[model samples]
Target: MKRLFFQLLLVSDLNVKDKLFKSAIAIFIRLTYFVSDIAKEKAPQLAANFDKNDLKSVETVFKSGLPTPDEYAREKVKALASNFDHSELKHVEPQVKTNVAVIEEQ
Candidate 1:
């Protein structure tokens, strides 16, 4: 049963590192939803932790959503080119470099 659950949680489309990150995000979202539902049901006061705007954002994501990866990448490139700030690049470059290094190491 444990093995089956683990397998079910795995997303085979992603390579190992991506798979792990995706799995973690997926688990976090599931846990968040579960806790939110419990709070809404049993302890209404706890639901205040997730504000109206946060709930609306989640609902919009589920209903409307972000673009496809290709579209998102193209838009990101356009935004980066237009905004083109060295300060932002400093923040972004390290994360990209770290992710690339980790993937390569794996």
Candidate 2:
């Protein structure tokens, strides 16, 4: 069937050795995007000031060994908690609490 052939094509496109390489490449791309988005959000002034050269520099740094957004977020939160009296852990707490309450009620 046409569907089966397409599936076969997808699978055969990558051998075992290349599969790992492709997966790593995919993960890197995803992490780069995540880091870029977080950087943009948290440092809007810096992001706004970024020229084409700046973007290229960021891309180069990210491709080398930069941490992903999730890693950056964790470090940033820890740093803020340690340095400041007031800490904000607002995003996940509410969703987790709501999910627990729903499960208990059910």
Candidate 3:
């Protein structure tokens, strides 16, 4: 069961990593805002030191080769899937549905 859960978590096509990355950024932004509010109340001079441009420029430090979480997950999943020939498990193709359905509660 644990292995199955782990495999699902590492499923590349599900875009779990992308969703996780976005969620993490949202949480970080909220935490930053909360911290800044506290800093502004306790120490205005210290809080003033944080500049938006300085923070924005921090992204430049990361190299171009830096893979986003989704890319990393895809690579890992691909590697794992490649090794499945040795195991008893089989890879299943994903299915797509074009129709949509909506049911409202009474």
Candidate 4:
């Protein structure tokens, strides 16, 4: 099915052996789990930004090895906000708290 194919494609891309790709995927996977609402908000931006240049940014976050997924997502989001200079960055903290509460209840 087309849906399955797309899912496979996404997963394959995420599983790339490159450290930067892995780090970005870590961030994305964590977003999918802990903060899915925020993930939804970020996915499109991530898709658009997932390029050679963005990999440099992701790489800059990890001097030695990959960080935890939450840390990756936070840095990635902050990087995105800095590039955009948008007001949406202001909403992320409150959403993070709400999502944490939701996860705790589960």
Clashing pairs in 2: none
TM-score of 1: 0.26
Query: Candidate 3: lDDT over CA atoms?
Result: 0.62
Listed in order, each prediction's TM-score against the native is 0.26, 0.27, 0.29, 0.21
* lDDT (0 to 1) per candidate: 0.74, 0.72, 0.62, 0.73
Per-residue error for 16 in candidate 4, Å, reads 3.2
Q: Could you tell me which 10 consecutive residues in candidate 4 have the lowest summed lDDT?
A: 1-10
lDDT of 4 by residue, 1-106 (tens): 3455456547767666566765665666655566757778899998987789767877887755867789999999999877995577687878999999999999
Which whole-number lDDT from 0 to 100 does residue 89 have in model 2? 56
For residues 1-106, write the lDDT of model 1, one tens digit per residue: 4454456456444446666666775676677678867867976666556578887888888866658888989999999899877898799999999999999999
Q: How many backbone clashes does candidate 2 have?
A: 0
- For residue 82, what is the lDDT in candidate 2? 81
After superposing candidate 4 on the true structure, give the runs of residues whose Cα lies further than 4 Å from its correct spot: 1-15, 37-106
Q: Which candidate would rank higher by TM-score, 3 or 4?
A: 3
TM-score, structure 3 vs. true: 0.29
Candidate 4: TM-score?
A: 0.21
RMSD of each: 24.9, 24.0, 26.7, 28.3
